[model samples]
Target: MKENENKNEIVEIDDVDREIINLFNEDGRMSYRKIAKLLNVSIGTVHNRMEKLTKNGVIQKFTPVIDHSKLGYNLTTIIGVRVKGGVLENWEDRTAYHKNVLCMYDVTGEFDAILVARFKDTSELDQFIKSLLREPDVQRTYTQTVLNIVKEDLSSSKML
Candidate 1:
């Protein structure tokens, strides 16, 4: 993301757009009729604006959050990975096939990549990490088990 991204793009919206996004950010399953009533707009208008927003990539995807513990995946971990050969750039392909890898990031810090993962047990986690180490692009990794989940923000409120 560039610092000049918003400066280069123009996004002009009335108060209704802001309110609708806020309401939807709070709950994605809210009905369009409810949104229209709250904003005092027609259902058609709400539908059109939401459609435009979705098409323009303002709203990426609607998804659910799950309790993995119930599924027997009780371990959570954050890994800091340093890699080579531009693997950081192709992380989408690198991690896409991994179901337990929840998220990957090319971040600015002590590491080149960061990954959050959930696993059924330590052996599975060890195998995953071992394979990651075998990648010619990957050099080293550091990881820590997560004992608590303080907050989870899926909607990215700034966009709303």
Candidate 2:
């Protein structure tokens, strides 16, 4: 059900679809009826468009953006890592349970994997680091503290 060509396919999007996407990108929880009212379209049209959009994979899942610092997680870092001994296997399964993990990427540069994580303080970060080191295949790890987040969001991201 997934196609590699669909990964970055450029398609002509109607203004209505673009508006719907833009509005939802701004606020995912906005009601369809409210959107319909705003767009001056029928509720059924909104529903049908949304269904088609999602089924065709034009829209992914909607989720809330959280402020981890307000939740007592102030420390954020990008930990460049090297994995050996076929360690990338089942890596997602191993790390999915970690609450502090923000995102992970397999890359081809100086690092085999890049882990973006957050913690409440130095202790928590140290503990997570120690845990990563325990993986025998993990040869080395370098962490850089995130001093600031200028802009991060779907609005800033490139869309198809």
Candidate 3:
């Protein structure tokens, strides 16, 4: 966050920083030299900006975007959990560690927590749901299968 090497301190993002983030959002593998050329800035500038971004926790990690369907994880499900009183966060924290779980969120409406997970088929999903029901403080779950993923982008660049 702090351009001064102290990561704990927050720093304001300028246009150059946004441009650098947008470039990385488009292609994470884009070299600093390339980014520098594109932005008409020095390679050191790009490198320093990226370093600050990482230290500040803006860019968590550079990872490949895997196609879940190609990996045989064709079934995408959203499981809404209604947890017992005072155990919502505990249930969410526990369930988030499951390998199949992609993400979890404490939410409003009828459910206390929502889990986004992937499975190979309905049988796998059924097993996961049953296992969740067996956990203490898990009141009930409503599972919805995702028919299609119209658009999914993990990048925060769009927020800029």
Specify the highest-lDDT model's number: 3
- Runs in model 3 with CA error above 4 Å? 1-11
Candidate 3 structure quality by residue, lDDT tens digits, 54-103: 87777778987778889899999999999999877777777799989998
Q: What is the lDDT of residue 132 in candidate 2?
A: 87
lDDT of 1 by residue, 1-28 (tens): 6545645465666677788788888788
Provide the TM-score for each candidate, comma-separated.
Answer: 0.81, 0.86, 0.89
lDDT of 2 at 22: 78
- Per-candidate RMSD, Å: 3.8, 2.5, 3.4
Error of 2 at 90 (Å): 2.3
Model 1 has a clash total of 0
lDDT (10s digit) by residue, model 2, range 1-160: 5667577765566888877887787788999999999999998988998887886778767778888889999998999888774767566568746888888888888778888899999999999999989977778899999998886673432463
Candidate structures ordered by lDDT, highest first: 3, 2, 1
Candidate 3: Cα lDDT at 89: 70
What TM-score does candidate 3 reach? 0.89
